[model samples]
Target: MAKKKFPLAHVYRLLEPGPVVLVTTAHAGRTNIMAMSWHMMIDFEPPIVGCVVSDRSHTFGILRKTKECVINIPTVDMVKKVVGIGSTSGRSVDKFKRFALTPGAASYVKAPLIEECYANLECTLIDTRGAARYNLFILKVHKAWVRPLGKIVRTIHHCGRGRFRVDGSMITVPSTIK
Candidate 1:
């Protein structure tokens, strides 16, 4: 197959990382949920994560004030709700109430963990140096939870604009290789 150079605008679509997550934030009794796809793991032990939350987003303000959030890993079954929540601003609507998401108590953060997601990570905003320049936040995941049966909790990864890919197969690499 012949290859042609693509435009820079389409560059992000090529390196789409990990699954889309619903970030939940709370501050001064105001809680909001925003669907995000720009999160990545930065560490192994202690589990540090990096995520981008634009200044224009309402969740960003709450996150800055509270310095806490819950990273909710939704499954393929919740794709519709993920896209639906991403299309609107959480400031205008009570996303939890409007979307019928059950918010569960977290062990380390004030932000509530989303009960519907396959996995939930309680995060504390550890650094904000990149937030002003790149809309990125450095978080430390203090607590984590995953659904019991892996068979039922299949997650979705973002490919590009409005397109998502769900987990299809499983492969386990031998630890002895290391």
Candidate 2:
């Protein structure tokens, strides 16, 4: 039997239910935003979230120290900005200034919410073990804000690499037992 080798782009495309996430962090009065696709909801009772931030990312350092962050969910219109933020480092330049984005203070976290995003989730670090081991952080969502129009707007979904897909029509599933 022969094993086939594939690139990460190809492998990531197979991951279903992908959502583009914008991670916000603040330190020393400086706030930054970084795009991420490696995020997901973990629990409902306490509203937990999981996100992967590389050890070298500037946001990682801020998050580690502040123990708080905001997860902003953007619409398809922000795909370009999302990719741009992910490609650059916050230490070099201010992403909000460079990208002309507005920052709004979060209700529960020090990290500011991105004004252009469709939704924002304020989170506080629940554990640092995963962050130290796998560059993963588990956060407990404290509060969330959603744009009035965001409910009707489509969101960008990452398919890995530079290819991103937009959210399509929604369908409500009925319970079989009901």
Candidate 3:
């Protein structure tokens, strides 16, 4: 068997940690949504999450100022809308109206939950130490919402270059840690 060398620039595409999420933020009187794929779970208890939001993005400024946001997990069925949201900026356009997505009130945050997503996590900004150096923000989830088990759908994982991989069959494995 032979293995070919992969480009260093594309390495991140191969190591995407989780499903693409639509991060919603609200400040002053407006709401915005930014599609994010560079996020990962940092802890189990209290559900800490760390995500990178480029400083240049509109959501970055709002999140920094408000210290609140909703991480909405969309499914494979919304691939087109996810891609469109990622490409468009929330600076000039209203993503909710442009994409025809419903926004529901979040119990713990000013940001609205994307009703079309399978799950919505209401989070508060916990730390910003990495924001200046890496554009990273640490979040603590205060509340979460999800559809009934029977209604849940497979999530979509970004693989760079406008390509995505959908969640597939599950394989159970024995584990002592929980």
lDDT of the candidates, in the order given: 0.88, 0.87, 0.93
lDDT per residue as tens, model 3, 1-178: 8999999999999897799999999988899999999999999989999999999899999999999999999998898999999988899989999999999999999999999998999999999999999999999999999887463368998898888888877777999987
How do all models score by TM-score?
Answer: 0.94, 0.90, 0.96
Give candidate 1's total backbone clashes.
0
Q: Which stretches in model 1 have alpha-carbon errors above 4 Å?
A: 151-153, 175-178
Q: Residues 1-178, candidate 2, lDDT per residue (tens digit)? A: 9978877767767774557888999998788998888877788868988888999989898888999999999888888888999999999989999888999988898899999988899999998888778999999998989878733578888776688888878777887752
Alpha-carbon lDDT of model 1: 0.88
Error of 1 at 28 (Å): 1.7
User: What would the per-residue lDDT of candidate 1 be over residues 1-178, giving only the tens digit for each residue?
Assistant: 9999998987877887788999999887878899999888898878999999989999888889899999999988889999988988877988888888899999888899999998999999999999999999999999999988655457788877788878777878878762
Could you give the candidate ranking by TM-score, starting with the highest? 3, 1, 2
Which candidate should be chosen as best, given TM-score against the real structure? 3
Instruction: Kindly indicate the candidate among 2 and 3 with the higher TM-score.
Output: 3
Candidate 1 vs candidate 2: the lDDT winner is: 1
RMSD of each candidate relative to the true structure: 1.6, 2.9, 1.2
1 versus 2: better TM-score goes to = 1
The model with the greatest lDDT is: 3
CA lDDT for candidate 3:
0.93
